[model samples]
Target chain A: MSQFKYRADTEGMLNTYLDWYKQAEYILSLKPSLPDKFKTSKGAREYHRPQHIIICGLGGSGIAGDLVKDALGNEIKVPIEIVKEYTLPSYAGEETLVIAVSYSGNTEETLSCYVEAVEKNCMIASISSGGYLKKFSEKTGALHIDLMSGYQPRASLPQLLFAILKTLETLKIVSGQPYAEVIQVLRENKTNFSPENEQNKAKELAEKLYRKIPVIYGHSFYKGVAIRLKNEFNENTKIPAKAEVFPELDHNDIVGWEDNELSKNFTAIILRNEEEYMKERIEATIDIMKKYGAEVIELSSRAETVLAKIMDICHLGGLASIYLALLYGRDPALIEPISLLKKRLGEKVGLQKKLLEKLSKTVSQ
Target chain B: MSQFKYRADTEGMLNTYLDWYKQAEYILSLKPSLPDKFKTSKGAREYHRPQHIIICGLGGSGIAGDLVKDALGNEIKVPIEIVKEYTLPSYAGEETLVIAVSYSGNTEETLSCYVEAVEKNCMIASISSGGYLKKFSEKTGALHIDLMSGYQPRASLPQLLFAILKTLETLKIVSGQPYAEVIQVLRENKTNFSPENEQNKAKELAEKLYRKIPVIYGHSFYKGVAIRLKNEFNENTKIPAKAEVFPELDHNDIVGWEDNELSKNFTAIILRNEEEYMKERIEATIDIMKKYGAEVIELSSRAETVLAKIMDICHLGGLASIYLALLYGRDPALIEPISLLKKRLGEKVGLQKKLLEKLSKTVSQ
Candidate 1:
């Protein structure tokens, strides 16, 4: 790890990546029990199985819902809708289970949705570190899982995601996710992704991506992984990156690669899954991209389980994004544009203060 | 229209754009009734209102699901889930209203999903021009809406979209979407987007996006429209374009715009909605992007109704992409890469042939 200058890792993001398995291990070990409120709630006591589940949050925290949906959409008995906005779906009511996730517990969108969830009389559970969401959850007696503070919400994915899975498990909505196996897979694969490994795939992929835009491709099964990688590239590499799923991209995006001159500016990262039903289509798409002069790199997971496969690809992409940032002489930890936007939003609209007040007033009433 | 080179418009795409109102009006005028199958189906007669609705399709055909979800997601009583994959959700059973859309009736993914819908005993309805989906629908007594053929699936959005809206309307799932008013808005605004109109905002936007990668931003409400514009740019303009929703992008994507040198090669198109809850954040985001030296173009719809607003922006974007294609001397109608991919897939896997045969055998059985 010391072989590469760590100047840009202001928050030791690499260390966090290296210890992701540990974070997952610790979170799973905690084995947080379902809140008594959920068990005693009228909706739960009535035992009318939720018609659908709505996971409401945005950005880093909201991604948990996407991951869960991608991993369990086929297996989950009820539909799961992710809300990355300020309001819950109009149909979300007593039969809807709304899980509000916010790392800071202060995300205005999540806070707003929490207020709505309360008003709709939807069965609600929440996960947050400590902020208005945590306060509201405590005040309203909704199920709340407390996360550890001091990490960026994006970096806190393992904690947030596992908490969501655990909550769903507690509700008996899903079971046997192979959390331990996924962590073990990450634990074994970490060394290959480490900077000190001379043949690190992450380093090689980052070299291929340096100074070029990345277009990450995944199939339906790994759609969330594709999005997670794109977000990682955006926040970590500080470069424009795009993600499009297969079959869908085969329909429209393949045409975008026709212009060799413009296509050369992109590096296509195909998150290869051996089990994808449209494997042949993905291969064809890759051939077309390469023929058009875009650099193509294929990344595949060795893990057998869906969760493990998702995390394995995500870990590799996450490291590659950091390496690309280092190659560009950028501080991977810095997100100045986001901060600037937040500052401007605060100064102009006082959105945070207003949302907090609104949540407090609404929940109290 | 004759003033611009028609070499790229071999399929009369521009003419289709001009006559969108007519296409929509004709579809609406048909007043396609619910098929007797749905009227007498166990799920429908029981009046145990569908627990959820699933729209399954891909690419040009599948985007109808997205548009419907975006336009009516809030007002619809049941949660509408758009499945862009080969399989329906495990929970999609008799209580789920499955609307399978495929313009050519031959999209493999849609065929696969239609088969699953049949097996799952889902109350199924389908929209397609003519293909395996139509064949299966006819033989199986599923409600089927026929669209006129020849237009590319992407170009057939108006016909496909209206049919889906009409299906939902006939089912009493959603009502009184200002369809006539939306057509009126498109009819009134089409000329301003026409090539002969020198004051065309679409032309101006195309010029601004001429050589730059387009990054489209929309809030929760117009997320589908943003995706439509991105796809239009990819398919029509033959350039890599990206779309991310607000609040979500503000979390991670904003960090990617910090490098002015790389950022200058990109143009940001903000799909502005005055009714957006986080308007201040979007404005702040634009400020930050401009500060980082990225050119920003804000496109807003003047129509009062949600449906009208959505169509207005989509119409403008559809034209701008074609104009951008003409600027690059590329044929907007020639999706060579997609054709190449399909050819390769056919040679290697014969996906379409297999799906058609499978659907035929399954429906017959």
Candidate 2:
């Protein structure tokens, strides 16, 4: 829409935007392997079967739990609840499995919940590049999955998702290696969205989405993808976007589009898959939104399997968000406000030193 | 901000707007009674203990599940997952409690999920006024809690919430009477927000929220209220609004506010309760939003218990939405577009007759 044009070079002013595209390949190329700490631990084998599972993390790190919940929710025997709060649920006790995920391992909410989980004597695991979570895990002999460093947590989706799936397998809650199939699907499909292709659908969609609020919609399993895309739009494009899961959206949010003024600013991006049971309802909702003057864009998943379809759309959404950031002359990678908040928060509470001391004592034992 | 003024009379042009307020009082006066069908059924007593619970409904009916999940999530022995889709989770089996809620009982999505739950052999229960759901329940001999008719599903929050809580009590998932305290809180606080009260905080907040997008923020237990408030603002005011939970909001959405163009159109309403565990983080999020030029309005909950506080805020939020609707010169009750969609949908699918025929046969048997 603007004067922005597609560039073949990986570095297009913002390295982060380019890195997002490359990360899809990284995710695709990844081998399904668990970290030794998580796989080879006596504690991992000795742990009791939890009646419930609570995954604690926030933002990019936290969203992994959502993906797992949607993707493998029905497959797992126990209930898995995602907690993005500072405190653990009261039921998170000996019978609960607590997975603390933070890319930098310093997320205060995750750390706080981890502490609470430990006090409640819940089985614990940790996933992070490196930070207090790693140190704490080492001290407490908790199963830890060390992710590769130097990427934003949002950019670290592959590692986050892989680790979560691996944890599920290790717990014996789900059988077989599901992550491998997802990787294969990602590998086979990476070329479909390469920037070299002049007709890249993600790029085209991003161009259409320029200068408008993108409302992502999905149903059932795709609900996780909708949320993921909304997060990418916020963090990568720095745009105010929203995600609505269907049937729910059909009820209340569809009416909000009646306001002609606000409707003008939104472009509804509906994620469609043949697997969606309520396709007719989604269509009706799109019709209502379009009739009220909102732009509607439908992106259908091409993958055959449920997991593959989710990954395929997630890759497309990531690329689209990067393209949008480039169009707006934004860095895509820079989140100054979030960094500032984290910094100010650290200064206000200064929990890092206290956590280190606590962990060091545990490590000595 | 507008020429709209508060009036003592319940007839505020829109009967639905007046009805919502009256319904709050009606809820207060409710004796917390479950229908004989739900309480005394041999079928209800014969059901086995479910390892997990899945509540299936959409829109207003679906939100009841969320309220139960938030209020009693910690207390419940098993995990409860709310499904707002046409399909049931794969894990839903004999060991799953499937509570199907649909006010109109003809909601296609709910019916669809009900069918799936039946196929999965999930322990089923139904809550609705009357329609296909009622007929189906009678046919299947499932526990049914029939609600009084003639109100919008969203306006029927009290009945929906109470029936859900009552069902939980009957299942022995929760001990003692939980609804009584909430009803007491609602009765005592109803006068504080009466349309005649010139200094009513909800009305004042609604006035400030006029002609702007409302971004509601709450923490932990208050998250459900934030979502409910957002739904009310959308359906009742016919305006676009957003809800974000604290700690999670701090991680990503607060940065999205930095976009000056998008920030200009939003009024941030932060729901504060004395019991909020992450007060510091919530305050930080508010500061960041305000620093980016978004108008910040804080509404504090006054009730003592968690359930009471949630209900207290929900009641206040309902009044605010109605007030905002009056200000916009929009009728709070008319959902003509939804009705039109439903009519068109029925014509397209010809489902009404088929569902009736199927259920009628079951009812007769």
Candidate 3:
């Protein structure tokens, strides 16, 4: 068996993160109790205008934004573009909305895009804890939300998610208050990371997944959590992981599990939320998965807000996966192959430049 | 490449598909009669009954269904589920709709789930050329579409896409035919795909993409074709490839292009149609990508139904990628790693099955 190397002391990682999460908690706690006046985006003047949104960040910070836009894109009317490079979109004019999200405002891509956004006269908003993004927000007349800064970006996902959702609300795209219940749930979370039966479901779930490739399942809000779980396994444990949402998996992928062989190296963790409609379906999916020969773990959220619940779940998955990573003796931070390719890509220049030029001609014609 | 071999003839690959384009002239050669009116589904009653959809199938057959769902998912009211495994959802019941799609109709997982769908009394349909699925449909009085056979499933994407869209329309989710103008334009293609122009665009495209990754991009209907292109590159070219769609890519991934030395290894192929409203924005994006030195290709349809245009583009990409594979000496048909994994997965008691039993207990509770 390969050794999955985790941090020598869990306390170290946890301590570092606790300080950051506290910052996020502090920001949320300061909101004065005002009468809730919700805005209907469909009725907003901005709805009729041509606006573009440019998101700047990379890796975990970037992927989260990507998934959100991908999952909710059909609903979003204005074009939302994620900028992974230093340059901004050409049409990122005054009407463009620039969202600079960086857990550590020092992120090169976000900072660079920040400069571009400023120059372009785009509407700007920022999410981070005291970094270039924050400084830029202060320098310019931009809305800046300073989140708690200690946890890993993956752990601080809820803070990031809610922050973005709130921004989108300001843009009048969707209602944000409906998510308050999720936030409330996550805030109530207590760190019972025991893995002792019900008290430590994350730990117990990890143990259950010891000899298997983990496939996380969830419906509704937990779908993101499932993805976070997969990334946790990928980044922390360095193990193969996959996540799929409910009712949808029933279609084609379900057939892939008919053979008992798929289970030889597989375990499934099903996240159960209080959703009345999805609850029954998750139950049914669990049965169908088990009938085909697999291990399943059922876990419910115990956080104070939707973001908090997601964070807590992510923390649980991360801790467990980190342990799994340590067990395999793999370095948690080294994603060398991806980095190498990025390097190789930087070197090749001649062919790509021409392609882009030609593509422009085709589009213009 | 570890001495990989191509499945079809080398020379025939490039021009043969282009010749197939000439067969479009054969369309001009035809005695114009009643425009071929293929089946248009009219039954939403059986489908959309459940809050979600589960699609099951494999390879080209499975992926084609996925593309349809991916394209229409955002516009859809209920979630569309796609499962590539051998089981049914535990939650799937009389209210659930299960569509078993198999080009050849003999896939093992599809067969198993086909039986499960019957037992569960789920609304079911079959899209197959011939095999157990067709047989089962006949036996069980299920709606079945016997697609045209003989062509490679990848080549016959048009049939599969049309069938699924027709199914979705019957289900009343998308609820529109606004695609008529776009489809008509692409089918009646007048673009230069011939072996002539100073830049034989298609041939030059085939030659240039010979050694690098093809990162296909698109906005709407071409989204599926982009996926098909990647799969063709992977399954046919045996190369690592990716596909990105707009709106979402703008959120997070766009930022990764910053400082990416590896951007050169990727050639961005933008699949656009006349329907792209944000052409200016995409052009700006293309400029930023080129400035960073990434290859970009912009392609439009031949003016037909989206199915027609999609198939035409896919056919072109398919031929180009296959020839590229031959140049690299990679076998196109061997999915040995996946085959081995399936063998292993079939041998074990899958964890999903165990969860199924536990879920049964929960539902009974």
Q: Which number leads on TM-score?
A: 1
Tens digit per residue, CA lDDT, model 1, B65-130: 888788885688788888888888888888888899999887778888887777677888899989
Top model by DockQ, which number? Answer: 1
Off by over 4 Å in 3: A1-155, A160-365, B1-54, B69-96, B106-120, B148-152, B166-202, B259-264, B273-277, B302-305, B339-365
Query: Candidate 1: which stretches are off by over 4 Å?
Result: A1-4, A38-48, A351-365, B1-4, B38-48, B351-365
Displacement of the residue B267 alpha carbon in candidate 1, Å: 0.6
Give the winner by lDDT: 2 or 3: 2
What's the TM for model 1? 0.94
lDDT tens readout by residue for model 3, A151-197: 55655665676677666665565554445554443333334553223
Candidate 3 lDDT tens digits, B1-365:
32224344433343444444343333233221211121112222234345446788766777777677645634654446666655764556666667788887766567667777766667777778886677666555566767756555554555666666655555554565434543343333324444344444544665677655567876656766776777677655555455666643543234334424334555678887743224544665676666656778888765455545666677667766655665666544444334444444434424334433432332233
Ranking by TM-score: 1, 2, 3
**Which 10 consecutive residues of model 1 chain A have the lowest summed lDDT?**
A38-47
How much is the lDDT of residue B214 in candidate 3? Answer: 66
What's the TM-score of every candidate structure?
A: 0.94, 0.88, 0.51
Q: What's the alpha carbon RMSD for model 1?
A: 2.9
Give me the candidate number with maximum lDDT: 1
Question: Least accurate stretch of 10 residues (summed lDDT) in model 3 chain B?
Answer: B32-41
State residue A247's C-alpha deviation in candidate 3, in Å: 16
List, residue by residue over B73-136, the lDDT tens digit for candidate 2.
Answer: 5788677888887677666776788889999999887787666665555677888999988877
